[model samples]
Target: MTKVIAIVNQKGGVAKTTTAINVGAGLAKHNKRVLLIDLDGQGNLSRGLGCKTKARNQFTIRDALLNIQKGILTNPTKGILTARYEKISVMPANKQLDAFEHSLKGDLDAPFYLRRYVNTLRQYFDVILIDCSPSLGLMTLNALVAADSVMIPVDPEFFGVEGVEQIVAAMTDVQRKMNPSLSLEGIVIVRRNDISIAKRTNAKNLRLRYGSKVFQTELPTSVKASEASARGMSLLEYMSWNHLARAYASLVEEVLANGRN
Candidate 1:
């Protein structure tokens, strides 16, 4: 079965895109056919994977969504950019997506469009990862409705905990009203700085609050991540020996283990 995971946090700078990119890369490294869907208008996830978001010839996630909304007949694989060597593919996005939410306003079936779109892709991929925008808006709702599970990335900060609370509340709403099968994959501590007492405290609080729902692996702060993004490479590919890369590898294992359970 193809498993779709939405890496989401309603707050920015929490490494949601980072988690999506690396986790997708990690899964691909494990021989899984992965498709990354960039739902964020910022298009950072698309760019991070070396996709040309501005390419006029490329079919973006926005286009796909529009097709779904308008009931347009189009090839499902039309816009997917595949990295054959990495076993990964991308449905890119750009600033063109910024107005998508407003366009879907008051559309009763908006939430189901993404689910419908993703269904067409289920047979082609072993995994699909959606990189949500930094808000619990219509797009994220679509993602929540479409995904089998969600993974939240948090920096070790007070507001990070608050972000989790907000998204979890949204998840609860989604479960009750939208997708009853939606489950939380886990909470990940990103940009962790163990030397910082406050960060450690926040990490402890998160683990205590979420218990085993928190992943055992925590991604450490690293400039290499930014560099890798700049170079359009996964951390595992950019610097496999880096500690953060190793942590992400462990995270992939945990994700697979959770799926088996």
Candidate 2:
């Protein structure tokens, strides 16, 4: 069975897309067949994987969902793009997705569209990771409904706890009213600078509150990571010797262990 995990956070700039890219790449390194779904209209995840979202006649996540909604048939692999990386595929998205969300208004079954679409592709992949937008809107809700689990990324900021609270509340609501089997995979602390007192305190507070739900490995902020993303490559592929890349490797180990449990 395919394990679908949504990389989500209600707040932006917390490395949500970055985490999604590296984590999916890391899992692929372990020989896991991974499919990345870009649910954000920004299309950052697609670009980060070196996908040409603006290329002529390129089908996007927007097209896939709308096609699913309208019951239109084209090709089985209509919207999926093979990334340059190993063992990974992507369903790209673009700015047109923002308008696509609004068109689903008044549609009673809007929230289940992604779930329905994903059901058709479950047989081919070992894992599916959905990188969501920074809001808990209709698109993110669709991700939640389709996913078996969610992994939240948080920066060590003052408001990090508050942001986690909101997403957890949304997860709770989804559990009650939608996908009852959905679970929280874990909370990953990203972009940490241990030298800063405020960041240290904030991270300590998060661990104290969330306890074992927080991953033991925290990702350090690095210019190399940003540069790698700018060049459309994951840190592990761009600079495997970097400390941030090693940290992601450790996190992937934890993710695998958690899956076994």
Candidate 3:
């Protein structure tokens, strides 16, 4: 059985994609087979994992959903694409995904497409991480409905508190009206600078509200992340000896412990 966790945040620049990539990669390094699904049409996670989403025949998550909807692809698992990282697979997405979402706009079952697609790949992986867009739209709703749990990466900035509130409300709605089995994996505070009073104050607020849901690990701002992305690699592969890698590794441990698959 695979534990499907969606790395989600309604606000951009919260390191949602970074957390998804590193956590998936870190789990892979633990000898656990992991698959990363890029739910965001922007394809950031796809590019971060060394996948260039260009041609339609390449088969993205969007293509899989559309193909399944149109009766073109019978097996949803066939859409899983191999990434550069070992022990991990990816269902890449690109800008074309926007059109696919539009195609399913008012369809009653649109929110369940990802759940149906993930059902076919459950036995093949230990974990599946869906990197969602920074919004509470249909795409994010699909990921939330499909996932067993959700992990939010809240940046330590001012609006991070508001972002957390918005997501919490959405998650509550999902559990009530969509997926009743949905659980919160954890809330990770990203890009924290302990010395900055503003960052410290915001993080304190998050802890006061979410309490134990917040992970102990706080990922600091790192130029290495961008450098790694430039080279199309995870932080684990980019600089495994550094603190950034260790932070992500610690987060992975929490992720594994929280998720019951």
lDDT of 2 at 226: 80
Ranking by TM-score: 1, 2, 3
Clashes of each: 0, 0, 0
- Writing each residue's lDDT as its tens digit, candidate 3 over 1-261 gives 679999888888788998888998899998889999999889998899888798647778887887657657476577677767545798899988988988897799899888888877888888999999988999899999999999998877655578788898999999999899999888999887656787788899999988999998999888898888777789988898778888999988887777643
- Candidate 1: how large is its RMSD? 1.4
Over 78-120, each residue of candidate 1 has an lDDT whose tens digit, in order, gives: 7999643355799999988879878888999999988999999
- The lDDT per prediction is 0.89, 0.89, 0.85
TM-score of each: 0.96, 0.96, 0.95
> Could you tell me the lDDT of residue 22 within candidate 2?
92
**Per-residue lDDT of candidate 2, residues 1-261 (tens digit):** 689999998788888898888999999999998899999989999999888899888899999998889999767567798876545799999999999999899999999999988888888788899999989999999999999999998887644677788999999999999999999999999877656777778788889989999999999988897888778778888998899999999999999998999
Q: Which has the greatest lDDT?
A: 1
Ranking by lDDT: 1, 2, 3
**Alpha-carbon shift of residue 54 in model 3 (angstroms):** 0.2
Q: Which ten residues in a row have the lowest lDDT in candidate 3?
A: 67-76
